[model samples]
Target: MTGTAGSSRSILEGRGERSGRRSGGTRTLLIGLVADPGFATEIAHRLAEELPGALAERSGYRLHCRVTVVSETLSRGEGERIIDLAAQRRAREGWDFVVCLTDLPLSANQGYLVGDLSRRANAAVVSVPALDMLRPAEQARDIVVRLILEWAGELPADSGDQEIEGGGVGVRSGVQPVAPTDEDIDVEYAAPAGRLRLLVGMVRVNRPWRLVWGLRNAVAAGLASAAFGLVSSVVWQLSGAMSALRLGIATVASLAMIVLWLILNHNLWQHADRRDRVEYRQVRLYNAATMLTLVIGCGVAYVVLLAGSLATGWFVVVPQVLSAVIGHPAHVSDYLRLAWLVSSIGTIGGALGSGLESEDSVRTATYGSRERHRPPREPQHT
Candidate 1:
């Protein structure tokens, strides 16, 4: 639309209504924050609180920005176009502009995409996973404001933070212009850093912290094993004799064992034959995200086990009894070592006990499972 001279463009000069004026009075323009469930919806809710004031401040009070969140998963249609979906939603819901927030990792020009704006349709798509994991809500807010301003031709051309390539089909920072077949007037992306950020965002969306709750049985079994190990004289002597390096190795091995167990047992690893390079990368990102989520989830579980073991060992074990078993005086270091060793053993035990969890339950910790279950609405494109 931007390439076509005087083509259909929306919200001319920050007035979101079709006409440039609203009865010569400030009109409340609706900005829809369409988000996928989970992390995307959470972020959208956060955005709604501050976005109106933000839009007013950024636009110099040129338009009254009112945000409304629509929690729904927007899926890909033929040729990977999502603007059609946004346009349909915008029209159906009577929103002047729409910003679809999705945790799904989007690719453009064979790399990572931050978001895209269609001037004519007044709809944009922002991949929440493409943002930095640190304060992603703030980042999304800034990006949304920038996209809206860019659509309305109100943002200055000199803003060095981002600039549309050829003022047409690409975002800055190593993103190339869209091909002739692509309809997006402008798109945003990150280059070398996009992969890591996207991965982090996807993991966040999966809410790996919830995995600790999901693995309650694993925790129970781990604690039971750890309780038993605390009383074992052989464990006491072995922990005192083991070096720190060996203890560290044990910790890693235990965590890895459970991570691998969860992946294999739940079938979290994604597999597909994608001919397109972009699709292949997407699949790889999903697998990487799954691995990352499980690692984090297991890591949290391990930490909880370690803390519990430390507290239990501190209170339960008598220094005199431990010294008698280890043939030396039990010091604070000895107690620490005991906790470390016990936690590791308990993690391994938890891996075994993980069988108590159903595949459906374990799948909650994986990105692949979430994607598989995300409902895709039928195409409403004309």
Candidate 2:
């Protein structure tokens, strides 16, 4: 299989080179427009119409650029899939360069996505703020054309020589430079670092809450398991022959409930990215801490219940750590008490942890200290 894969790759590379040569030296430019779906489509449409004409006039190159608009909301895997498709097409047909344009600021994950794709696909990546899309069509056209020219090695290296005509009469030339907005840039660059800090802070602030929540989940799961076990034991007592069937049904139901709980929890955590940008490692640590706290809470609750049972002289309903070994059955009430106590503690701890994580994320997301606006020094104190 590996040999076949290697041979296929060799064939593809050879074909890709041949395709590049067959295009009559008219390099195929793959322009990837990633942004808000609605905005990206609009910008792409304008580019499709205006670019060829603008480039033909400005650079004197009949540039055949193909613009492919990809919405940035796609998952990282999905984005890679799209890039793979583009590369395959390029290799078969022919492409000179791939340029990616995004309406997101460079400081955002979306901005990072563009950079990632640029490096992976060996394409030029450009980021433009969404607000800039509101500029006049001609103005937008100019920026796009200029960017394309720059990528194609047609634009002058220095900024001084570049001029845009018809500025005042609504043909806004060079209105908004082709650069990411300050806000977008700030978020893109600051978010990951900020998120990490936020996660750490949350761990500190919400440790108690997380401990509580973990206890709660653990107790709930344990009670459910114990109940199923008790019910199975009762079935065995009532009907010796049919006990196995009854026990099987109870086991299946318990398993189903556990599976459902797990699925719901997984979904909630998966979609919580917008809330805290929580990654897998952070979530794993949180779950571990929570479960440990739950166990501790349950142990404490068991001791309390045992003390109460002993003082009340309720010998009929005794809390036993191991029913079979002690020859004393565990009471349902004791299990209920433990479950509720543990769950409450776990919930509290989880909430606290999540909040702290969010705050830490925000703090860390902010880039290097804002430039302090210092008052100019008074002329020499002579």
Candidate 3:
């Protein structure tokens, strides 16, 4: 009876081992190192030595593991092929866990390709900062080994347990709260030109209220220029004796008013309060468009005035009409009407154009939020 009992126990133990191996429930790890030449082989070697023991000590589960060093110089398509090959091998051999360690910036095109490959290969990809070859190699190996052990059920899920607190076997809770750091605060300042920078500073100080101020300031400036230009033109037309000199003064004044109007409108657009930092490129583009619209508005106003005069026949009829009606002299009623018409057209067109351009600038700034703003490339080694 004693012999039969021992035989039954032995049979159960052997079956359990066979089942574990066949089903890949037994701890197994495959590590792939995709990095620059100098650090790749070193990581593979260290992972081979450390991972198996880590699994045993942490979870009491023995492991079968293999590590491979791959080159970073592989083309993107070639990299995908390599990853597919690795996945096929893992599926065929029934690998329980796969890990990829890379020492490349994750935002680069090459890095993105490798990341896609790792995902398809059913691997957790960890990026190691490539400050130095030897240092990152050690770091990569440690991280990859820890990750493999954790995934293969060789490490506890709750890393906070005092007993396994510093065993280097488990992952910490990924749910820890994060606080905003200095890097998160983006304050971009555009140097003051004319009056725009001052307006931008004021808007920053007041926040949302600044948008109201910006709109009011833009409209006020545009109207002020139109008013001054109209008054100057009327004064020149009425003073027939000194018309040439008065017209010269009027022209100079009109030009000054237009320049001031442009300066104020531009500043208002740029200074408008934004919750996020202004993108300099987009702002510049918007500014260019605004300037173009200003010029177009002024040209349109001049053309409209000429067309109004032709339609009214002011030159032929003005003197006779004034002699009969006012008893002395009057230039023409159409002059004031034409001035108002021109100003109204220009103002409306400029406002609509400015608003559309500003909307485009805002859209571009928002869309570019996810993009990494890389400075001009300094020459790279590889």
Q: What TM-score against the true fold does each predicted structure earn?
A: 0.84, 0.32, 0.30
Deviation in Å, model 2, residue 196 alpha carbon: 27
Model 3: per-residue lDDT, tens digit, 188-284?
A: 1111122232223222212222232334433444454444434344422353333445545544454345534544543424432354433453344
C-alpha positional error of residue 96 in candidate 2 after TM-score superposition, expressed in Å: 3.3
**Tens digit of lDDT per residue, candidate 1, span 1-382?**
3333133233443544443545444445678889987788999999899888877777677656778898877766545557668887898987788998877776665456667788778888878777656667876777787777666655655553544322312252333423323555554544334577678878888898888988989989999999999999999989999999999999999999998887788777888777777567778988998998888888999889989999999999998999999898989999999999999999999998887897666775677777676566565678
Q: Point out where model 1 deviates above 4 Å.
A: 1-25, 75-80, 156-181, 184-194, 274-276, 358-361, 376-382
TM-score of 2: 0.32
Rank the models by TM-score, top first: 1, 2, 3
Estimate the overall C-alpha local distance difference test score of candidate 2: 0.37
Kindly list the per-residue Cα lDDT of model 2 for residues 1-382, writing each as its tens digit. Answer: 2443344234324545432332444544445554333344565667667676666677655455566555433223321333343344444434544444443333333212212222224343333332222343454465556545544445444542335542301123213322334321211111122333333322332223333233344434443433333333342223223334553454344334433343344222221244564344445444443333323433453344334323332333234433543244645543443333333333333333333332222221111100011122233355
Worst 10 residues of 3 by lDDT: 184-193
Q: How many collisions between residues are there in candidate 2? A: 29
Candidate 3's C-alpha runs over 4 A off are: 1-36, 68-74, 77-96, 107-121, 130-138, 160-382
- What TM-score number comes out for model 1? 0.84
Which residue runs of candidate 2 sit more than 4 Å off their true CA positions?
A: 1-36, 66-73, 77-94, 108-121, 126-140, 158-161, 164-382
